[model samples]
Target: MSGLDNVIAAETRLSEVDGANGRLVICGHSLDDLAGNVPYEDVLALLLPDLLGPNPQAIRADLGQARVVAFRQLAHLDAELAALPVTEALRALMARLPDGEDRETALLQIAAPAVFVPALVRRQAGQGAIAPDPARAHAADMLAMLTGADPGAEAVRALDTYLVTVSDHGLNASTFTARVVASTRAGYASAVVAALGALKGPLHGGAPGPVLDMLDAIGTPANAADWIDAALVRGERLMGFGHRVYRVRDPRADALKGALRRLGAAGGMDAGRLALAEAIERDALTALRARKPDRVLETNVEFFTALLLEALGFPRDAFTGVFAAGRVGGWVAHAHEQIETGRLIRPQSRYVGPQPAGRAA
Candidate 1:
C-alpha cells in the first residue's frame, strides 16, 4: 500500500514555502518586501485579485467602512460574553457572522475582527470603543479604537509593520484549512471561519500570548535563564522559541523586534519589560543552542510578538485575536484562490490497526 504521507496533494499556486532557506512568498512578492513597504489594505487587494475588482483605494475604503459596520455587531456579541476571556468571546462573535454567497460580502465578514476584537477589549475594560476614523489608515484606526487615543506616528508605523509582516505565510495550518474548505465550494466566510478555528490551537496562533505569561512567571530577567532551564528539564515546550518550519529563525521575528525597538525608542513602552524580554531572548537562544546542538531551535515570531503587543498597549489575553486581524487578509485571499481553481479537496487516510479478524459476527 502507498504510504499516507505520499497521498497528500501539495498545491503550489495556493502558497509557496521555502522552509529550509527561511523564505516565504505570498502571491508574488517576498514577505520581507511587502511587510515594511505596503499598507495592510494594499496587501489585501493583492491577495483578493480581480475579485476586489481593480481598485486598491476603493477596496480599502470599503474595508474601513466594513469595520465600522461590524463594530455594532461586535458590541452586541461582547455584551453576551462580558465575563468570558477575550478570545472565546471573539470566537463566538465570529461564528455568528451571517453567511454570504459572494466573495465581496464574505470579505466584509472576515474583516470584522480588525474592528471587533479591539472594540470588545476596550468596552470590557469600561472604556468606550472609539469610532473608526475613515480618514485615517486602517492600522491607525485599529489602534485608536483599542486605546481611545490617537497613536503617534511611531506607534502607527509599528502597528502597520506588524500587520504587514503577518498578512500571509505559505499554507500555514490555518491557511491550508481555509483553502481546503474553500475548495469544497464553501463560501468565503465559511473558509475564514474554519481558518480562525484552526488558528486558535495552542501550537499555532495561540502562542504569542504565552510569552507574556512566561515572562510573568519568571518575574525578572535574573530568573529568566533558570526558569527556562527548569521548563526545559520538565520537558515543556518553550512558548516562543523554535518553529515547525524555519530551521534558523523566523524572518518575521526580526522585523517585529525592530518595530518594537523603534516603538521603545519613541517612548511608547515600559522600558523594564522591554529590557527583560531582550535578556530572555538572548539567554534563551544561548541555552537552546548549547543544549540541543543537533536541532536548530531559535527565536520564532512569538518572541517579539509579546513585545510588539505590549508596546501597542494590548493586554496579553488579546494577542491571538489581534493575530486574526492580520491573518484574515491571507485567509480571504487563499479562499479566493481555492474557489477560482474549482477543485474539491479530498485526502485519504491510512489505517494502522490490525486487519479485521475473519468475519464472525
Candidate 2:
C-alpha cells in the first residue's frame, strides 16, 4: 500500500489541483481566468451541479431567495447568541439549517453563510445587521449588508473576486472533513459544521488574522527582515508564508493579492501595509530557503487575505468568519456529492497497544 489509507477518490469532473505543479483549474478554466471573469455566485453554480442547474440566472434567483430567508433567521437570533465570536456563531446558525436532501434545502444550506455569518460579525461588533438584497449580486450585497454602507464598485468587485477564488479547492482539510461527514449520511449542516471546526485550527482558516498581527508587530518595511528573523529564531512559523500543497507559489495568493490591490485603491488605503507585507514575503521566502534548501516555502493565500479583509473594513477577529462565508458553498457541494455516492466513511485505526493474545479466552 502507498499508505494513503483514507481512500480519497481522485476526480476530474470540474476542478483539478496539481499541487506539485502549483496549478488549479475550475470547470475546464484556469483559476486565473475564472477569478478575473466570473462572479462569485456563478462560480458557486459551477461548483454545485445538482443544486444549481445549467441556467445561471435561475440559480442566482434561487440563491437570492435562500439568502433572504437565512438573513431573516439571523436577524431573529438572540443578542446573547450573537455575542459569541463570529465563527462560533456562524457554526451554530449553520447547524440549525435543515438537511439538504432536496434542491431547495441544499440551496438554503449553501446560502446560510452569505446571510448569517456577515450578520453575526455585524452583531458582534455592536452594529445592527442589514437584510439581504435580492437585486444586488451576492458578493456586493453581502458586503453592503455586513458593513451597512454601500461599497464602491471596485470594492464589491474585489470582494467578489476573493470569494470566487476561494469558493472551492480539490480536497483541502476542511473540504475533506465536509466530505467525511457527508459520507456518513449526516445532514448538510453537519458537514458544514465539521468543515468549520477544521477551519478554526491555526493551520487552516485561522492563519489570516495572525498575518495582520505579524505586520502590526513589524510596524514598517525596514523592520520586516529583523522581525521575521527574530520570530524564526524563537521557533515561530511565519503566519502567511508557505503552504502545504503548493511547491512554487500558491496561485490563490496572486488572485487575492490582485483583489487586495484593487480594494485598497477603492478604499484609498495607505499602501504602506501592502508594501511591508511584500517585503516580508520576499524576506521570509529567502530566509526559509536558506534554512531548508530542499523544502518549498512560498507566499500563500493568507498573505493577501489579511490585507484584503483589512482594506474591506473587517476586524482581525472576523477573518475566519469571512472565510466561512466563501467556503460554505464548497462544503455544501461536497456534502451533496458524498451523500449521493452513499458511502459510509469509517477509517480503521492502527492500535498501538499489544494485540489480543490468541489464548486470551
Candidate 3:
C-alpha cells in the first residue's frame, strides 16, 4: 500500500534511521558520537562484529591490503568501462570481481570504490591511475591516490568523518535495492551493482552535485535571500534543504558542518564560501518554514555534504562514487543481514486495470 510506506520489511541490527526524531544510530552509537571520534575501519568492525577477526588491527591491515589488491587488479584501463560515469564505471568494474557472500568479496567491494573511482577520474582526464599505498590509511590513501601526494591531516580527518557519518543509515533507497537483490540470494556483487544503479537517480544519491551548483549560482552571502525568493517563485526545489525523512535538521548535516569547520581551520576551506553556504541555509530554512507551515524543512545531509566533499577535492560528477566508497560497507552488511532472513522479498501488488478482458469491469 502506497509504495509499501510504513511497511516493516526486515529487522536489522546494523543501523537505525529515526526519521521522526532526526537521529541516526549505528550499532547502538549516535552519528554524532561516531562521525569524527571513530576511524572508518573501526566502524567497519563494529558493524560486522561476527565477521571480522578478533584483532581489529589485523582487520584494518586487511582492508588496507585489500585496497592494494583492488588497485592492482582494477587499475589497468578498459576504455569503455573507464569511459562510463564514475558510479557506472564502478558498477561495471565490480562486475568482474569474484562475486560471493563471503568476507573476501565484501572486503573487495569496500576497497574497490576507493581505487576504481579515482581511476575513472584519471582515465577521463587522459592521465594514468595512481597505485594504492598499503601503508596509508583508507581515507588518506584514497585522497593520496587522487592527488599523488599525501593529503593533509585535516583533509583525511574530514574524509574519515564523512565516510563514517554515511557508513550506514536505516534502509535508504540504495540499501533497500541492495537488500532486495540479496534477498533472492544473488551474489554481493549483484546486490552492490544494483544499489549503484538505484543511487544514480537524482532523487537519491545524485543530490550533492546540485548543491554545489546552487552554491556556484549564489556566489556570495549577500545573494542568499534574493536567490531563495526567485527559486521559490519559479517552483524550484532548494537542493539541500529538505529530505524525505527527517522532520528536524538531519544529524548528518550537523556532523558534516562541524567537519567543514575543522577543515576550514586547517586552511583548506574558503571563509567566504563557508559564510555563503551558511547564509543560504538560513535563508532557505526561513523560506521553507513559511511555505510549508505544517512540515519541517531543515538542512539535510546534502547541504554540508556537498561542501565537505568539494573541500575534499572530488569533482562534482564523482560525488556519488565517493559516496559509494563510504556506503559500500553498509551495503555489504545489509546484504548479509537480508541473506540471514532466508526469505525472498516478494511484496504483493494490486492492479486497478480492467480484469480478465472486462469480465469484471
Best by lDDT: 3
TM for every model, in the order presented, reads: 0.91, 0.93, 0.96
Best by TM-score: 3
Tens digits of per-residue lDDT, candidate 2, 34-147, equal: 775678777777877666786767878888888887877765688777888888877888877777557877788777787776777777777778888888778878888878
lDDT of 3: 0.87
Please give the lDDT score at residue 85 for candidate 2.
83
What lDDT would each prediction earn against the true structure?
A: 0.79, 0.80, 0.87
lDDT, candidate 1, 25-83, per-residue tens: 76777877866667777777777766775566877777777776777675465456855
Model 3 steric clash pairs: none
| Candidate 2, lDDT over the whole model | 0.80
Off by over 4 Å in 2: 1-7, 10-12, 356-361
- Per-residue lDDT, model 2, residue 45, is 71
Better of 2 and 3 by TM-score: 3
